[model samples]
Target: MGLFYSLRGFFRSPGAPPRDAGIQSGQPGGYSSESAAEVTFDSAMQISPVWAAVKLISETIGSMPFNIYEVGPEGRKIATAHPLHRVLTRKPNQYQTDVEFWESMALNLAISGNAYAIIQRLGNEIVGLLPVSSSQVETTLLNDGTVVHAYTTGANVKVYGPQSMWHVKLFGNGIVGLSPLSYARNSIGIAIAADNRVSRVYSNGAKPSGVLTIDKTLTEAQRAQVRASFAGLEAGNDDRLFVLEAGMQYQQISMTPQDIQLLDSRRFQIEDIGRFFGVPSILLNQTFGQSSLGSNVYEILAAFYKLNLRPYLEKFEASVPRWLMEADEAGRYECEFDFDAALLRADLQTRMQANREAINSGQLTPNEARIDEGRPALPGGDKLLIQGAMIPIENAGLKPVQEVPSGTQESEPR
Candidate 1:
């Protein structure tokens, strides 16, 4: 808490973690989940599906082409020369690269439904963005209608007004983003409980593989001794021989469908969690059967971006001007995550074909397309060209060049 006292209205990590999550994460307190297991962010990450889903979304979005664009009478173009441009692209602060900083912010957004960073400024000019976690911040709408965030850790609190912080929020009541983890805790608790059941089953070793019974009744002391011995054997004495007293007979327990059902339930829980996060099972590499979306994995991955990712991208783009730029620069500069880069990155064939169509439609000059593809421009490639075959609807059958009438071919052969 006191670590950030040097920076004005700034903090690294503030507030204690959520109840159940704190215990697992080795923090102070904890709460019981719906499934009676502790479902905190730390514990949830231990579950494979949760880890994969959060990582996939965070890394993919964080690494995509996030750019600053300047708007003018002509159109929008990359604002490469802007001061904030270098700050966001190269380094957001002294300790992190652009990718690392955004990835952390994206991770916070994925789990907590909000991401925040302190806007460091020297006088009126902005300097750096110091990232912080959702747990550290609390937001409130003041009576005068301003949103203020208070960062609390233990008893220390640091408050920040709109001008000093950048906030990216997910869908919620417009005051604060709704935390996905809080809402999904029940589902996560079930997964955690299922995992704990397996561990308990093995660790307790009370589930009998075979029972030894005697025709004569055994005394309480004898039964206790028998149970203790068997527990020892079950733990790590698999090769040990069990000597039965009083002509006991050994009976083996047959496998039951309940065991199979337990495994199945665990697998289903993975998909259940995926649905909450808007991540398809295919992305989790758990394609137990055919995907409902389709059998083509590529197509499903494409849909993942459009359906699961596009909203987040748009939210970030829309919030950046308000969050990062100065009020006076609002109309002049904006930010966007290159939607094409997210969807077309690996599909080079599709990218080339799309670029070709763009060029032929006169939407992009040949030189422009070349530059986009990281190739040098040709001398005449700066000009936009359209297909000559395109003709007026009414002149469909007429010769493009009105050929000289048969006799009108100016002295034909001569």
Candidate 2:
């Protein structure tokens, strides 16, 4: 049976503040963190690595086009005429385009570990979707194992069941998904603290200060004069130079290994953020050894789709039937993202290489390859072709000799 969480006493109640369950963003003490700096969604995004990692993942998955297919006797075919076709491809809601809707949904999922959309209906048919912020929505678990969701923003309050809320959750128990930003507070907080400290140091004075030793003791007035000379050696005094008069010998203070490691730590933090967000270091522009070598870029990219993105695609696909389609219709229809149609193919050379591999391996017909390249099909191109030299290992070196064709000229014995 379909479940519904009735807002028992809220139908006509006067406006009231909703309950606060999750940690709040943008506030210092809201997000629990061991580090000094606050770690909230907004604050974490201020970190460059965090921003890049989130953008890379959400944009890649959200922008990929998806099609609904009808599975039947012949084969799966695009269900273009279905109502979902327009909703998914052209428009997801009245105000937002399909791309915008999915991208925001992906962003929500990346940070909060959950994405919610209210199913806008015209009678019984779903016509549009309205995205709700995961921060403003909270899920409650009843003793009987029934999951209830409450959406609260200011005076507006809404209570709905799973049927009305299209929820995509990250890794967690069935009731609530674990929020990446929430769990990453400590790490992100430390990174933010490091970044801020470095920036502050650079801003105030990053220049190395030197000790100016005078051979003889100076009067109080002489010491003041000397101190005034060195005052101009701070951060913003690039064009100014301190005069080393009165037998003052200058000794330079070079950066120690500990100071150098501080810079290295910042670079490592980029990779740290990428790892947590399921983005490779290379994608975030971090250069490392063999794994990130230039020649292996293609392999890394291919692995990104397979390792990082495939599971995310599956998550979206798995949720479609439960949230978008009727029980009976769900069995007959399937949705798949066009992972290769555009984005992953990337370049003509890569696309051509992939097509060649598919055709040569008999996985695709010549005509199908042509279609993928957006070219006209050639005559007789529909026939599949493969390397005729390939044969079963058991039959290797044991092929029967072919008899000469009739009327064929035999070579003179030589």
Candidate 3:
């Protein structure tokens, strides 16, 4: 089977606009401009079909905050706040100092092989630097030929490296620990021991033998990749398992009616939010949840969409109508208007024409006007332009607004 078959289930024809496509292009009853702008794919699914699935889900459902649950090695049930949930539930008292400290520590370990470090920001003053080291950073090639760098603190057990940086934390007595090695080996068991400080590692029914610790000096890129991977993991888990149990008490605080009400009141419902906003929602929903104090799935989702998603969609939506109008007037929509292929093609054609004209006008030599496959090739070139001639459209009378000359002003210059 091909990679597409491995990822997506099967290939099907792209569907036409639904008779009652709720909101099309921002208008009611008809497809909203936003909805109309979306393109449905008809091609075979790729190896990672989740990307397309996520895009479709975001476009269809907007963005709602969700909870995530996962079973680590030994069936240890673990639950935490979704990152989206955290944003919605952000409070004035919430601070990033602790998180930042561990993050810095993770980065340092990635680059310098140093694990111990301190993060200081005293109203713009340097404060302290702690001792840390990377006991090991070894690259292991997988069966797929992917080289994975395993960074370990001590013993054969691997400490979370660039992949699991977020879980690294410095608890009481300044002790830091890595997330369990479940990602690498599922049956490899890990148990938080009675001390509440150390994690006991067990593999294949053997007694819990090893301990886990954190690596402090991870690089910014490593930190980002780790964070993104964690987010993806959380999203996968949310869709797959509901690990959290509602009505469960925490620290003697009952999950009561009032608490549920509070959570509902603060949580943001994802119904029609766009895809960009959905990224944060997926992140938060996977990271934080209702159980997260001062932060719930709703609040995190609400804040992210409000703070991030809305503005992005607005800008994107605003640009579409003009492009659509242009395509309509030109009677030549791109292979996929929803994908903005026409606009890309037009832009490419314009640049290529300019370059050709420049060469013709003695502004550049033939050598200077080179054509290379990878060198910013013009979109919808002669071949693609011919291929794009078959776009089907119901109307072609809508004229797009043309750019006016710089001197042609509607009002006096400020």
Candidate 4:
């Protein structure tokens, strides 16, 4: 079920003719035959780099605040106290907390290009949203142009209508979304290959193979005996040490230069995977001694939020109300992913400066600024405050009334 749509029809069913075992001829769409079986969301996760990148994006998004609001007629927005909010915060279902639910949704959307949740409602009110595993799901279209999703695992299959499921897609037509893992298969294959090679080296007692050479020729029986003797030394903890007869030599078979290059290729592959996921390499903790803006965590975080996270937030903000609320109610309600907390998380000095500017510019009341700083508001703080000396630039041309000389008596004309 984790299969890519490219392989959707290539799979076998009982009544269908046997097809090539998930292997397609030629490198169709940049994916080689060798990696067709390994490009699944689950398989991609097996590579450490892929997992790290996916986790970084998913967790960052999951930690963001999801808010529901009511937009009034005059275009004012207010936080809404809806049952869905309680359900999202307390338990989306029996298994997931708000964080866990959103994290899973993000992970699926990142890897498979789709996230699905089964909506459970009591009467007309939705009380829960249970996540369905993306790996176990398939989407199909009907003749009437309706889209249906079927979830199957083992012997069980469940089908859901559009209203019963909350589905979010990334970079796809109205019906189906394309998986990023499919496009990133080649880079992931390189990482997986590198990991496998290193694992094999360690599995063989961390010893490189070598060519055993002798100064003189030996009989077949003698050669067999020599091979057995070497096997005895190389089989166990003694692998680090080797004993040879006089005039016998063991020359280690060093990896060729081309083979050695694959080690460096692994590092580059991490960046490649990051690009496919739209996450900067620096966010993946990859600093290859090059200059990086990530040295300032706040700057990189801001870039990440704007470039990678905002578009996704917009998608959900639009989709949630459309699917979760009644049409009439949807007109009045809005969903938003709040970044205020992140904006307020700047260094103490920067946050203080920002607060000062906002307060002085009349953009925020004293109480509001203090609330953002997590401080108690003082009396009279609710009033908007601006700098006392701040005046209109046009007023600069007007001179204050010429004050009467302090020592002179006021004019009698008064």
For candidate 2, write residues 1-414 as lDDT tens digits: 001112422343533222233321221122332565887778999998889888987888778988899999999999988888788788889889888888888888888878889887788787888888998887876656566678998998888877778888876655566677866777787789888877765765666566778999899998898777675564453556567776878775756326668778787888777777888878887766445534565677788888887877887888887678899999989988888764556577877898888877778888998987889999978876665654433355675888999999889999
Q: Report, for every candidate in turn, its global Cα lDDT versus the true structure.
A: 0.75, 0.75, 0.30, 0.73
Model 2's alpha-carbon lDDT is 0.75
Residue-by-residue lDDT tens digits, candidate 1, 8-124: 124334453322111111111223323557888899999888998999888988888788999999999999888788878887899999989879888988898888889898787
Off by over 4 Å in 3: 1-203, 206-283, 286-299, 327-414
Ranking by lDDT: 1, 2, 4, 3
Off by over 4 Å in 1: 1-33, 153-155, 202-213, 217-225, 232-234, 237-260, 388-414
The parts of candidate 4 lying over 4 Å away from their true place are 1-30, 36-43, 215-220, 232-243, 251-259, 291-294, 389-414
TM-score of each: 0.79, 0.73, 0.16, 0.81
Once model 1 is optimally superposed onto the true structure by TM-score, how far is the C-alpha of residue 301 displaced, in angstroms? 2.6
Error of 3 at 364 (Å): 63
Comparing candidate 2 with candidate 3, which one achieves the higher TM-score? 2
Model 1 lDDT-worst window of ten: 19-28
lDDT of 3 by residue, 359-406 (tens): 545454444444521254344332211112222222233455688798
Q: Which has the higher TM-score value, candidate number 3 or candidate number 4?
A: 4
